[model samples]
Target: MITRFEELDWQDTPIGELTLRRRTEPAVGQEIYEVRLGDEYLMSSLFTVAEEELSTLGLAAATGDDLSVLVGGLGLGYTAVTALHDDRVTSLTVVDRLGAVIGWHQRLLLPVSAELVEDPRTSLVEDDFFALVRAAPAEGEGDYSAILLDVDHSPRHQLDPTHADLYTVDGLRSLDRHLATGGVFALWSDDPPDEDFLETMRAVFDGVVAHVIDFANAVTGGTSSNTVYVARSRTAGEPASDRPSKAGS
Candidate 1:
């Protein structure tokens, strides 16, 4: 039998004080894993439906086999692991700003950590996903077929104020340079669909859709929903060759 709760690991990161913990859920009578940054709850194993759907809905929009995927956030590993479930995905690069989060998976501290770390298609890269999207990849590296982002709370609320720019039209254009032609860009947001952000995405992408994923809420005993914004990289009358070919290593 496990104790009611246990702190698995703790680290002082440049962002904040990060902590991983495991606890027994009395309602479900099962162990739950959670990660917290400072006073905010970053992820909970109990509520991963939306996270998994972020990968599912994103990849569904992508076209082509042997897809290369770049995941902007590595939380409980559900998003990355779910992306690998698709046989079409040949390579997956998961980037997180904090190295401590990557260490949790490398150490197999979380239940799904081993699955992500052991998968040959997966590469755990420690870097700022936001920064990488705006920069060029290494010489041999290529653009990704899909970029799934789950970092900020929403287009309006960010974990860090510096992330505000990524929600803007200019910032999105910089990110657009990192995707292959017809590639997909998907984002997970805690809030409902924002019309303003939707307009912002449309300025760069050919088509954009916001998918609301509803799931059972164990804590609330009701249904909760999260929005996944899926955008295709090709714009109207834009030649495929005109788009920039760049990605982060």
Candidate 2:
């Protein structure tokens, strides 16, 4: 059999060594793309159900005709590209801390890269998403209609320690400032539903819901799940009663 694995690109980043690899699975006889940061796997093309759902569920909560969306992570470009599928999205800003990640899309290193970069509404920005949220625009001055994040593994688990603050009540409050009055915020987590984090989100946002997305895991021949938290920014004069906590699957 011919060689099935190839390392497309590798770079040393501030956090660790970033590498992109492509391999053909013998069982399925299909090509799969994967990204790794040092020894930890960042993302894989083999599974992207929750990532797409992040855009779907987030935008579903947003009420507007023309939507300006911001995506926190650019892994494999699934989340960003999924948002682009919605014609209502007038603009999309994808922020990634690693420049190399953005470079991958620009170079069309992955399958979804062309679709994400070809769109005029798409803008790939290299910056710290957490920092941007912390220094969000003044209330009501914020322009984005929806903000979706999938940077870390989960709220309790983070790729970097600095990201821990963003999961807290105060950090979420700052994030609330970045959205328009009726804008929505969504996050993807590798872990199961986190009631504690949901409570923290409810403190700042109105109508907080945690959605558990289940998908088929080919490797394990079993079902795996990820959590997507959807919440709307509290508008001025909005009653406290409007905040409702719920979970979905």
lDDT of each: 0.87, 0.91
Residue range 1-249, candidate 1, lDDT tens digits = 544989999999888999999999876779999889999998899999989999998999999987999999998899999999999999999999889889999999999999999999999999988888667666767478999999999999998888899999898888888888888999999999888898788778866878888899887889898898998898446743433222110
lDDT score of residue 225 within candidate 2: 95
The alpha-carbon RMSD values of the candidates against the true structure, listed in the order shown, are 5.2, 1.7
TM-score of each: 0.92, 0.96
Point out where model 2 deviates above 4 Å.
Answer: 1-3, 138-141
**C-alpha positional error of residue 240 in candidate 1 after TM-score superposition, expressed in Å:** 13
How many angstroms is residue 138 displaced in model 1 relative to the true structure, after the best TM-score fit? 3.8
Best by lDDT: 2
Pairs in steric clash, model 1: 137-247
Best by TM-score: 2
